[model samples]
Target: MNNDERIHLLAKELIPLYDDLAADTRLVVEEHARTCKICNEELRRFNATFAPLAAKEEVEPNAEIKPFKKLQAFKALMVGLLFLARFLLIGLLVAAFDPAAPRLLGGNIIMFYFPLAAASLSILYFFYRKLWFWVLVLFDVFILFFLDEVIYYLLL
Candidate 1:
């Protein structure tokens, strides 16, 4: 094809990339085919079409948005530990419900304390560094002792 035909070809090819280029682009293609028989007419027929497309307001990037980061394994470990403690509490409560064990030992309140202490300790450990973690462990031990006493009383 000639030079004009080539410009038309470029416009036709690039038309699909833009919406306005569809019908208007054909007009451009036809105009190129008619005028400038010598070819190399760089008058830029789609200059306005390209300008509006370029100037179109973009969906601005979320200024309030924060970048995503993966949660640390330690965090997940702590969560799992807490959940385990919860399950333990639930199991103990189930055991407590059995009437065969006597009201004192098998009561829900005493059983719940075991799991509560465990869960509390797990949470404390997860949030604290190595130095402060011993505090949670101590509390956990204290809860166990308290529960033991409750059981002992109930047995008597």
Candidate 2:
């Protein structure tokens, strides 16, 4: 087709054509528009049509709807507790490996205290909405049920 017909055809394909056009093709089209009246008119029309969409009004955030500082603080506290839970887990593991731990801390210490502490930590994790929280809970459950077996195998 002629120059005017070609420009009209390209104008019909507006947004998708502009978006998907190669950089070299876009530069060529821009150069062509500067010299060609039909192409220049098409370019102006395209810009004018989308100008309102491009010129977005700045939206002021609602003053009443502030960030949840309390929730963030709660999450931070939960993270701190998760670290404390890991610390307790490490201590339990160390004590389980120690041959004299039972005699020193009393026979029920390994059987009771660590598991109880782990369960409490897991309960705390229930409030936290993170993958690590679930992982920690599962790990605590494993330790609660099978830690004695692990100690037996290790001590043997």
Candidate 3:
């Protein structure tokens, strides 16, 4: 092909190469564009479309807004509480309707704790790496293990 035809074919890829192609490939395209007026103009036209956005400075959030809001902590805690309650809620529902549903350890009503604890730990999927996540998990484990005694003492 003639030099002009080669430049025309390569110019079509200038925009994509400039935006996202691998560094080595982009460098090769850029070298060709540097020598070809057509490719140079094509790349410049593509960049000009984004220049306005790139030139604009980002505004900071309002000073009144806290960056690390405690609302997240509250939400995580509330979800953790819900996780702990799910066991008792499901167990009570089953026992109330069936009246003959089996209980943990022959008579204890804490049978649901095992599966619910797994669900409770899964809360980390939402609150991963948060301080409240580990705290709630440990608390859930403690309650999971001692829920029978906890109920007995509460009744007394």
Candidate 4:
């Protein structure tokens, strides 16, 4: 096609004329329009035609939405509770196996595992999302098995 025909076709096919364009395609089109006056004019006209429609659809919110803040606070509370439960469960398991250990050392040991488990769970929670929830559970089981082995060796 001739340059004018090609420019017209490109203008019609441009994403800004219709829908969202891929970033790479948008860059290619924008670069071409920058160098070509006819294409630039065509794109300008396309944008001008649609700009009014886009502007008319804009709606200003009358009131700030507050429900999302409440939901976020609830999520934070649940995560805190989950960490606390994990620490307590780990402490109870360790205490059950080594009840004769001095309270000072026992408390220190439990504190160590609390941070370790919290770190592990935090990494799994952020990175894995819902797909690896069971992985955390399996990790707890593995920790329990390792503790059992340690207790058995120490007692023997």
Using TM-score as the yardstick, the better of models 2 and 4 is 2
Model 3 — TM-score against the truth? 0.41
Worst 10 residues of 2 by lDDT: 100-109
User: 3 or 4: which has the higher TM-score?
Assistant: 3
Give the total clashing residue pairs for model 2.
0
Pairing residues by index, what is the TM-score of model 4? Answer: 0.34
TM-score of each model, in listed order = 0.27, 0.37, 0.41, 0.34
lDDT of 1: 0.57
lDDT of 4: 0.64
Per-residue lDDT value at 47 in model 3:
81
The global Cα lDDT (0 to 1) of model 3 is 0.62
Task: Tell me the tens digit of each residue's lDDT in model 3 across 1-156.
Answer: 997677568657556556567787677677777887878888788788866765574456564655566877876686767765865664563344322332342233355555665665675656565775687678666665665455445444
Question: Model 2, range 73-139, lDDT digits (tens) per residue?
Answer: 9877867776776667557655656565534333444565566666656556666547766776786
Clashing pairs in 4: none
Would you list the C-alpha lDDT of every candidate in the order shown? 0.57, 0.63, 0.62, 0.64
**What tens-digit string does per-residue lDDT give for candidate 1 at 98-153?**
44554454345555666676556666666655654685566556545564455556
The residue-by-residue lDDT of candidate 4 on 1-156, one tens digit each, is 787667556755784544367777777677777877867787778778887988887777785655677766776676666667776876665566644553434455445665666666776577447745566667665664465555556665
Rank order (by lDDT, best first): 4, 2, 3, 1
Weakest 10 consecutive residues of candidate 3 by summed lDDT: 97-106
Best by lDDT: 4
Residue runs of model 3 more than 4 Å from their true location after superposition: 19-41, 54-75, 83-106, 112-119, 122-156
